[model samples]
Target: MADVEDVQVVVAHQERATVRVGEVFLKIDADQRRTDVEVEAMARAPIPTPQVLWRKPPVLALAGLPGSALGRLGEPPTSSPKAWSAAGAAVRTLHDAAPPPWPGRTLDEVASSLERECTWLLANDVLPADLVTRNRRIAEAALRPWTPVFMHGDLQVAHVFVDGDRVTGVVDWSEAGPGDGLYDLASLTLGHREHLGDVIAGYGAEVEVDVIRAWWSWRSLIAVRWLVEHGFDPAAPGCEVDVLRSQV
Candidate 1:
């Protein structure tokens, strides 16, 4: 039998919990629909993903990826530029593949959510009005129509696993669906703007820089509240708050 001492809580919040034991991960989610999407997305993704070990209601077990995550929030990446570029290439491959059958948010939906979040932030005095206003203007560029692609939806750096200069796998597919390709790119480079050039180079296609920038703001602004409520400190160095402040 596996030793109970090996278990470690990776993340825990009101809605879900993820624990690691030996070389496997156990995810417990409140909503089964999200797990359904995660299973489907992993099956559909063209790139490498953690192997699904087994599934039982509310508990999905997965084999661990081979390497450490590409990076973490609030810290500079130690991985080489080549690794960053490899992640970009992996993203491009996913985007080029057939999109997921499920629908994603429309531009109007994103705009509405941003409006609602901004109102909450302002009413609660969570951030300065000027900071929110400036970032909102920057986020406008992303509200334009976009061609849909298979998106990881939460392609944050920590979700990507790398071995040396190659991408080994990507995880966390709960939000995967047909969405803007640039949003994935933006998510990968959110707090690591210095790596944007290397990632864009590896993406190997013409992309609109301004639109990517717009997603940075949109993602950061919309995530602050969720991050806080989840017991994460968005105000920590190199986090969502820093990403917003960097625009100044």
Candidate 2:
């Protein structure tokens, strides 16, 4: 093993912290259960994921995957549209695989959470009342029941790595479980609407664009509070707030 000298903070908050040391990543989380789920999900997933190097209570180590992330939130994707489509194809592969043994949030649970988040946003005056209300209504379209599939529950663009037009790997498996496939699609395309058609084309399935749009609203509305609480700026250009405002 190479000596770890260079360390970079990937993310840090009350719940967890992730740092990179050379080619290895060390994730520290107080809850072992989440780490357990992440390890198990990586083992079960059909798509590429970071290899687990080792684990210790409160810390899990993983070898780095090849290539860079697909893109970041609140920024234009540097990857070609073809790369985005490749990522879409990769997601489809994961969805087609056998479902994970664990369950994920049901549509009712999602709706309930959305409602609560909306209430909080309004109470906190996070945005204009009309803006929140309009987006909430749009979110309703995503509340309908869906047949569960193997989902990378947090398929944010930053979690997906690409090499040329091919998807090299996807990181962050703590949120993987049985969930709606569209949720993953929506998450991947959240702030990158221009790539939706390319992604869908590579998905190799008929998907309702309207439903995906609904999920965009649902996801953004629910995520803003969490991002704020966690010290991320969702108001940045091309981020969650902008995504919601773009709906108008």
Candidate 3:
């Protein structure tokens, strides 16, 4: 394996960079990059994001926050509750800062993208129809009532960085979109009940987390179905099927 440091890894998980007009430009991974660019641009955010520092087609300058891809607790505070409160506040600040409307894509466009990805998964024989149907149900429920808000579509602990209870930064900008806040919450906790409960309690919002938890449970079941049908690899870990089995 190549060292990430030696390679000057400007962008990863997509492809290599190319040069044009004596300057390096990154080729956008059409499957992913557009949403990242749009969401960051829309936010016009104060916090530094990777998308804003575009170099060229596939390259961008990194902000050099000293953390791993899975985030780091740079310093430990004396109290966990205090640390949790501060981290929650930081997340609220980021979400409350509104972004511009994502220019061209409509709800229909997003639906189409979902369909395409689901179709691709099915074609590859990597997922099951039962999972697809369940995913659709959860998605529809999430979208049914609320107006769209900016969502970190794939939020997780890995994207979060903390320095002694203070949030230093959020790392990935890809897979961002306009969607339900709870959807973002679901992704963030990834069905970890305790963690999800902590985040909800910390937020202190009026809304019930039960609805969100329901969505998360349903969504998680879909994921488990996919993994089971697809055949698990030794490198991957999941208990989604176990959770579903308990429910049944």
Candidate 4:
């Protein structure tokens, strides 16, 4: 039903797609799952982000990537620690940019998103029952009361891009919101824990590293659960369900 073409979905999730439109890029949500589009549209001008192309029914296009996600690149940085440090600095800049309340979101909203994933898995008869209890516990621990700040809810390495060891752009804004910034830090830092300490420290929030690690581990577990539910191969990279189960 949509007329846009030359379509290339650079990154995709359960409900949205990132497509190119001429010189710019657009994120088109076929299912109106997140209500923050209009708000983001108004507020993005002040933030250091890609130029938004347009937003109408069934299509919200924005600037296409100036580069690819850093994590997905085949080569590791000459100094991995420095690369992550730069990423933390970048996230801080994006979060500090002024914006209004992103409608239909709160800390509770984040908790609910995790719950819904579990529910979907269970309904599909794919969730391992024992793992379900463990996930619930992790989610409970993560749903703490905290000040709301802009968070890249899905800030994984693959969602980032780099050029000459310098971060060029970050893809995917579907999960952007106000929450714990440390959680976003953890999402990108956990897998590279050895180097992460310096990275988080460079971000100027040494106190939050432990909390960020907890969230980083929690999200890894959730990703495993989602993969199992969707019938994807868990042996693939980033699957942490087996490790999570061992901890139980």
Q: Is 2 or 4 the stronger prediction by lDDT?
A: 2
**TM-score result, candidate 4:** 0.71
| Residue range 138-165, candidate 3, lDDT tens digits | 5444434555665655565556655665
Off by over 4 Å in 2: 1-4
Q: How do all models score by TM-score?
A: 0.98, 0.97, 0.62, 0.71
**Residue-by-residue lDDT tens digits, candidate 4, 154-207:** 777777666655777675666666667767776775455555765665566555
Worst 10 residues of 3 by lDDT: 70-79
lDDT of each: 0.93, 0.92, 0.49, 0.61
Candidate 4: stretches off by over 4 Å: 1-8, 12-14, 20-26, 33-42, 45-47, 73-79, 103-140, 224-235, 242-248
In the range 107-219, model 1's lDDT, one tens digit per residue, is 88999988999998899999999999999999988999999999999999999999999899999999999999999999999999999999999899999999998899999
Query: Candidates ranked by lDDT, best first?
Result: 1, 2, 4, 3
TM-score of 1: 0.98
For model 3, what is the alpha-carbon lDDT of residue 144? 43
Task: Give the local distance difference test score of model 3.
Answer: 0.49
lDDT of 4: 0.61
Candidate 3 Cα errors over 4 Å, as ranges:
1-39, 46-54, 67-85, 103-140, 214-235, 239-248
Reference-based TM-score, model 2? 0.97
Ten-residue stretch with the least lDDT total in model 4: 70-79
Q: For candidate 1, what is the total of clashing residue pairs?
A: 0
